[model samples]
Target: MTEKKLKVDLSVPFPTEREAQIACGTLSVDSEPKRGGVKKELVVKGNVLNIHFEALEARMMRVGMNSFFDHLNLVIETMEKFGPPEK
Candidate 1:
């Protein structure tokens, strides 16, 4: 029998391309290699950040997504607080 897998795709937009790149690079650095069933990808395209996630089980996928969003919120907050003055 074959195992089932799941994926989640997300895109986040920032006010500037530099901000998007910063977030992409920072988050990418924080990511750890998976030894089991989860994978993540992040890319920056102009002022947008694209995220992809893959997991082996529904529960794992859900947990991964939730954790990602939580970390994302922190990243956004940090950018807002420490990023260059917004225009």
Candidate 2:
């Protein structure tokens, strides 16, 4: 049996490039658990954060996306609570 391949791409924009970069850095720190045919990538472009995910199956893709969103939410909250000092 052949596994179905899935791909997901998401982009999130922040008020400032600094915040976007911070979120990207935090999200990139840990990689997905060793799961075959699962891949994730995070990047920052100006004030936008980009995420790409690939999985061998729909279930795996959903789990991976959920995990990413959970962490991404934390990153956003952290930036909101303790962002750079107002200049």
Best by TM-score: 2
Instruction: List runs of model 1 lying over 4 Å from the truth.
Output: 32-36, 85-87
The sequence of per-residue lDDT tens digits that candidate 2 reaches over residues 1-87 is: 976678888999999888888888888998888854579988889999999998988888888888889998998887778866353
Show the lowest summed lDDT stretch of 10 residues, model 1: 29-38
Error of 2 at 71 (Å): 0.5
In candidate 1, what are the lDDT values of residues 1-41, reduced to their tens digit?
A: 98767988899999998888878877887664475467889
lDDT of 2 at 31: 86
Clashing pairs in 1: none
Cα error, candidate 1, residue 65 (Å)? 1.3
